[model samples]
Target: MTEEKGSMLQSVIHPTAIIDPQAKIGPNVKIGPYAVIGPNVTIGEGTEIMSHVTIDGWTTIGEYCRFFPCASIGSEPQDLKFTGEKSFVIIGDRSIFREYVTVSRATGEGEETRIGNDCLFQASTHIAHNCIVGNNVIMSNCAGLAGHVIVEDRVVIGGIAGVHQFVKLGRNCMIGGLAKVVQDIPPFVIADGQPARCVGLNSVGLSRAGVSEEVRRELKKAFRLLYRSGLNLRQAIAEMEQELDSSEEVEHFLRFLRNADRGICRGTKE
Candidate 1:
């Protein structure tokens, strides 16, 4: 197996493009027609800069990533109170930013906006400044994350979902399409609604990811205690502790629920 190499920078750059001589571009980095790479930009090896894309000040892009047409990265944050802060946008390796996606630079002085590796942002997705995204995450078309939101690893945010500011979505969680998530979503569950409610365990996702059946069984019981039973929040927690067998996954779920500052979603209505 030969090592996969990308298109060379000089060979791939279009003659009509404008790139700053001070920009740091690595080997096998492709810049498409009419693209713009600013002086403060540093593009890593094997990254492809597609047509009409603009990568501006203080942006660092890792290797082997692809940016689709018209993706505007490293633009100033949308915060009105911003006073030209010295901020940056950092994108990790192997991520894909689709057409028309917008990832803003960090909001405050000396801060940074971060995106993790191997994630996919579909067309028209917007990640606001100061947002933190984790690895292997998927943000569907038109999905948006407000400023300071935290999206954990392996999470799938459905199309057209609008996540409120300061919300934290836990690992392996799934948000249904068109949902408005204004609260913190716990790990390993499905959240869906106009205001987003916890429907149930993410069975399809968990099974596809090779989670054990025994673990799924325990999760089901925990869901029943927390959602189905008439017990209040504290009572539900107590019941889960006493009735279900303890496991790391279960404990993590409980801890997430307990720490929800914005509150958790409601379970499915019977």
Candidate 2:
């Protein structure tokens, strides 16, 4: 049910919810029992903030999103260098934050902790300061990402996985359960183990995403060249360029390799 409070048409807010008067709440939004919305927060239409969810700071949540019970968004950064600078947590549409998930705001002034559309952050997942999470990403239960981490589109982080600070997880990469990611992961790769070694191409994920078989074959060839061929990094890249026909997938892989400042994750053999 909805209510009209004076001139403003208020959305359905439970009686126990504490929403600051300065907060901008769109139509059809639902603030559940005991949920707290801070002054500078803006929740878009059709979003639901469940019981005991706390959304504070300068957070902006998009339409059709859901925050489960006890989820904490726009919380202060854990970094010691954060000195109350103005930062934001921006979430895109159709994302779901499961129970106890925590997303912290950025540390630097005017920076943002951004999450793209259609992402699912499972229970107890933690996204640290200044992280950029791309569309359709899934973080399983208890996954944790440190400050400045970048998770690209369609990536799946397994349960209890821990990604270190400043690491870049490339598109369609699958990180195994309990993996410790300390380096950059290139696109379409399956990484697992303690230090997260690249096992092989993410064939299942590619197939599920409707990637053409021809592209998969080329990626497999590139993977073999990079991991199995005993050649050095430069040699492998050169071989891939010379042997493989140019395609979007090949270009993306090469570009990721070229720009990886923290170094790419190596295979078990390497």
Candidate 3:
């Protein structure tokens, strides 16, 4: 049940599958029984679409990805103001989506929902319209991200967490299970609770990501200055700039703090 085409093999599509004639399926892909691929969809090479999966709208999926059964991708956004304008969902390579995961396309015309490489989305996860997810991110079961949220690289969202709309989760951060994240989360921190306050630095995640020990110490100092010193936000930032050695990590941390519009999560008073 295989067909060779040029340097790559054509897909093995089940007889029960329904693929639109204009859909573009890449080499070595597999579409299982009862799967439906809509006209504007493009699936990349070696990707697998399992049974009952529905890939609709103007979606572009990257190579070697796996879509589990009952996953629905690139559907129209849930926004009530959406007027059926054309939009897209673009997913990167090697991403794995488990059963019943749903990803919505953008709401505005010509806008796109973007996901980066090597992400793992567990069962029942929902990524709302126009979300930007960076590489190596992991979303555990039932985690939901609202519209226009930004998730940076290597962020791990625990099961049953819900991130509010317009929130930005920075790189290497971890959100504990059942958290309700309403504000921006800066990089290298661990946040949890009903409103998801920062509890400590994400030492384990930073260590696994190979962040240098010197940088870690500097980050610790910066965190203490920002949270423990009782200084206001502006004062803490100014002090950090003046006191800390200018490393890449320090610069990035400061930059994130400066750019935060929803205000960064606060730490619990010890």
TM-score against native, each model: 0.91, 0.97, 0.97
Query: Can you write out model 2's per-residue Cα lDDT over 1-270, one digit (the tens) per residue?
Result: 346373225678888898899998888788889999999999988898999999999999999999999999999999999999999999999999999999999999999999999999999999999999999999999999999999999999999999999999999999999999999999999999999999999999999988899999999999999899998878889999999988898899988888888998999886
Q: Which tens-of-lDDT digit does each residue in 1-270 have in candidate 3?
A: 345354335788888888887888899999988999999999999999999999999999999999999999999999997899999999999999999999999999999999999999999999999999999999999999999999999999999999999999988999999999999999899999999989999999999999999999999998898878998889999999999988888898899999998998998863
The clash count for each model shown is: 0, 0, 0
Return the candidate ranking by TM-score, descending: 2, 3, 1
Residue pairs of candidate 2 with colliding backbone atoms: none
Q: In model 3, which regions exceed 4 Å deviation?
A: 1-9
Candidate 3, number of clashes: 0
The local lDDT score (0 to 100) that residue 240 gets in candidate 2 is 94
What TM-score quantifies how close candidate 1 is to the native fold?
A: 0.91
* Model 1 lDDT on a 0 to 1 scale: 0.88
249: Cα error in model 1, Å: 2.0
lDDT, candidate 3, at 222: 89
- Kindly report which residue stretches of model 1 are placed more than 4 angstroms away from their true locations once superposed: 1-11
Model 1 error, position 244 (Å)? 3.3
> Which digits, one per residue and each the tens of the lDDT, describe model 1 over residues 1-270?
112123233436767678887788888777888999999999988899889999996999999999999999999999986789789999999999999999999988889899999999999999999999999999999999999998988899999999999899987899999999998987888999999998988988888877788888998888888778977777888888888888887888888878888876677762
Per-model root-mean-square deviation over C-alphas: 3.6, 1.3, 1.6
